[model samples]
Target: MTIGAGGGSRSNSRSSRTNKYSTSKLRNSQHGSGAAGGGSALGGQPLNGPSMGPGKGDIKHRFEIIRKLGSGTYGKVSLAYDHKNEREVAVKLIKKSAIENKQDLVRIRREIRIMSALKHPNIIQIFEVFENRDKIILVMEYASGGELYDYVSTYGSLPEPEARRIFRQITSAVLYCHK
Candidate 1:
């Protein structure tokens, strides 16, 4: 449900307020944008990574769109060159409407805030948050290695010891969080 120009209220639950990005909203927005003739701005262009936020025409920023990485219900990802930094970054542009409710927006904002607080090798890093009139752009470090689930799923189940080792590694991350 796309909200009006003004954003909605905030949520209270931790899960509801944390990691609120959902596949459902991603799907809906993807469909709607497709209907509106907002095809990807990428195509044959070379992409450094995924970008988030407005399209090439819509955004007034000087970011040169290298290629489109992908998109979900909330927004599309593009590979862009940051003219100022002279570096590549993945930009995620999330529309306000992709949010299910006010709580969802709050959760996403919280996640961005948390990302700004951390610096670790094991954690995904968010570099900056750029806000235009209605949308939020999340510039993040691109992980090109793909997801661990994909590797696990493609290779089949791992041996018990290997799984345990991975679990231990995750446990170490949890411990770091606690610290």
Candidate 2:
């Protein structure tokens, strides 16, 4: 998907909201989370609907899930605390099916490689990659502030000077990448 205005407005809107449909309705619906089927396009079991929180799942062993941050075709993301480090991290759980095919595997590996190599202030850090029977969890730096899109959306277009500052930062980051 093309990254729009920085925060993935369209895709995130559908994935982030918890009130799209009631929990029971989501569980019962065809695209519901509990449907006994192959799985969702992104690899999540199903829309299991709005959850109070992550249940007692196997993930607890590795990271303590703080809250559900977002979800996508791939899987859900949670603000989790790394028990080992005593710090918060964003865990992206991509289902096996999402990266099961050979092509996807290659892409995933390439993305991981690129992320591992990059070190810039503007970029998020990838801490680790964890795999399980049905999922791939990406441990990433947790950025406390909401995405840039939220700022623009809330305040309308940014002031010219403010936009210029952001542009300079992005340019510097690109230059660093070229180095």
Candidate 3:
């Protein structure tokens, strides 16, 4: 998957309306509200299709984990191939234990809700979110651009033109989100 539109053109007014509805739908979804409490994400089952068994079985059945992409405070992201979609996707693996409390869960859910709703060239498209007994799995559009910190660290500094190009892309994405 690429960092591109989810493929449609909507008036700004209508787009915001749909985005609001979509976020609400995601936040209130009972099936996805497991993980944090004593329940399972996807209810310990595969959400998008048939389950392989239990635990990591659902993930194994659906996506082929290719390699590690990166890691954050909660989990690591991996490049995986979605068997159902026939495409590569980035899988964000966040352990249920990693969520410190209800607030963290809320923040995560908010991020997921927003991500699932956004359709932009610079934002990765979230495909599906699920969980095993131990971890929450987020499937998303695969973009292989390395982290900005890593790029800067390796090269020290970018040429003025290169810096401007990166800056423009970042601002445009942020502005899109703001709108």
Candidate 4:
């Protein structure tokens, strides 16, 4: 989906306060601790919808990798097309070998849970998670809008109004997470 440059004003600020309490309650119910939590933050529900078993083949069998988007110590992110959905997506490929211990694995799983739980318009959607013998592939929503830093570098400083608009979107997203 294309994220535009404006339209983030909220008329009822107090509604967020009410939503905070309800959201927390819903989260608590949906994400119980330990094995009871099931496979996902949504209380046993699969995060990526249906199961796609760990098969012995290339991830490219499912997604057509378009290009490398970015990289890090853990893994690389690539722009890809989902064959099943016929849409663009970002795939994060994390090597299984890079996970040092059980704790590290747990942390990665937690990150998946958190990302999958997020449903805000500003937040990227986690479409699917696939694990092979070597890597963990996360298929996520593709944001065509480049990084904020890159945007700033290309355009120089934004006007005050434009900056505020972006800032508001960022703050609203952060507030949603806080809730």
Clashes of each: 12, 4, 0, 0
Mark the regions of model 2 whose C-alpha exceeds 4 Å error after superposition.
1-59
lDDT of 4 by residue, 1-179 (tens): 22423333211121222322322111223322211112222111233432344342234344555567777776777766555555666777777678888898878878887887788876777877765455666777777665667777877999999788778778878899999
Candidate number with the higher TM-score (3 or 4): 4
TM-score winner between 1 and 3, please give it: 3
lDDT tens digits, residues 1-179, model 3? 22222321111111222222322112213323322323323435444422333455344445555567777898777765555555666777787688889899778777777777878766666767775557767777776555567666777988998677667767877899999
* Top TM-score model: 4
Error of 2 at 115 (Å): 0.2
Scored by CA lDDT, what does every candidate get? 0.50, 0.52, 0.57, 0.57
lDDT assessment of candidate 4: 0.57
Cand. 1 Cα-lDDT: 0.50
TM-score of each model, in listed order: 0.57, 0.62, 0.66, 0.67
Higher-scoring candidate on lDDT, 2 or 3: 3
lDDT of 1 by residue, 17-126 (tens): 12223211122233333211233332122122233333332232333455566788878876554444444556677877677789988787777776667665455566
